[model samples]
Target: MALDPTDVGKIAELARLEISEPELTSYVHSLTQILDLVGQMNAVDTAGISPMAHPSDSPLRLRQDIVTEQDRRQSFQEIAPATESGLYLVPKVIE
Candidate 1:
């Protein structure tokens, strides 16, 4: 797909980008090449292929989901400026 200067300018306006004329010309060329590349990639046939998170078959190694810290809520809450019923109290800023 070919992108003209007007199209590029509209895209830049929508993205809130301040682009100069020289940069707009450069971006037009670069964006046109990227779209062409994406079009070519989309033309490939990948029938009967399963989607994968990674190319390799190795499973992800993750740490066990277990609590590793002692619960010191009461000790920490004692130093706070305001706390009530195991929850912190804050001023109502909005009316």
Candidate 2:
């Protein structure tokens, strides 16, 4: 799939970019090569292969669902600029 210079110009206009003639030519060539490579990859046959999520050497292990934290309300509130009734206070912005 060969992308045209005019198409690249239109894309640049939409993105608010000023692409020069040399850069546009380079981009078109690179994009064409990438499309060609993808087209080549489309010819591969992978019919019944299971998709592996993670590729790791060792056995995967998940941590148990447990809350390992201490309640630090006073410590947290101490850093706040303004606080009211154990909650951080913010300026009312509604008209």
Candidate 3:
């Protein structure tokens, strides 16, 4: 997965980026190294290993789900220019 200048140029073009010649060379080198590292990682075997949600084994501490703010939907919608069936309506700009 060694990225060449042409590959970097195509990528930059696709991403709508205007990169200089020096920057293009730097990006090619950096991207090639990243791809090589990914390739090396993919080469390792993890046959029986289970996927982990987090790297650590400790459970995450979470706060209780509670509503702190009062509902102001009705008040907001009352000031809107258009609303219908509890939903804010907007002008149709598309056909």
Give all TM-scores, in the order shown.
Answer: 0.46, 0.39, 0.45
Model 1 regions more than 4 Å off? 45-95
Compose the digit string of candidate 3's lDDT tens values, residues 2-75.
Answer: 88899999999999999999998899999999998888877779899988888887888887898888989999
Worst 10 residues of 2 by lDDT: 50-59
Q: Rank the models by TM-score, top first.
A: 1, 3, 2
Q: Give lDDT per model, in order.
A: 0.94, 0.86, 0.90
Return the top candidate by lDDT. 1
Give per-residue CA lDDT, model 2, range 34-62, as digits (tens).
88888897687878977677777467788
Once fitted onto the true fold, the runs of candidate 3 whose alpha carbons sit more than 4 angstroms away are 44-95
User: Relative to the unseen true structure, what is the C-alpha lDDT of residue 66 in candidate 1, on a scale of 0 to 100?
Assistant: 95
**Candidate 3 clashing pairs, residues 3+ apart or interchain:** none
Best by TM-score: 1
Which regions of candidate 2 fall more than 4 Å away from where they truly are?
A: 44-95
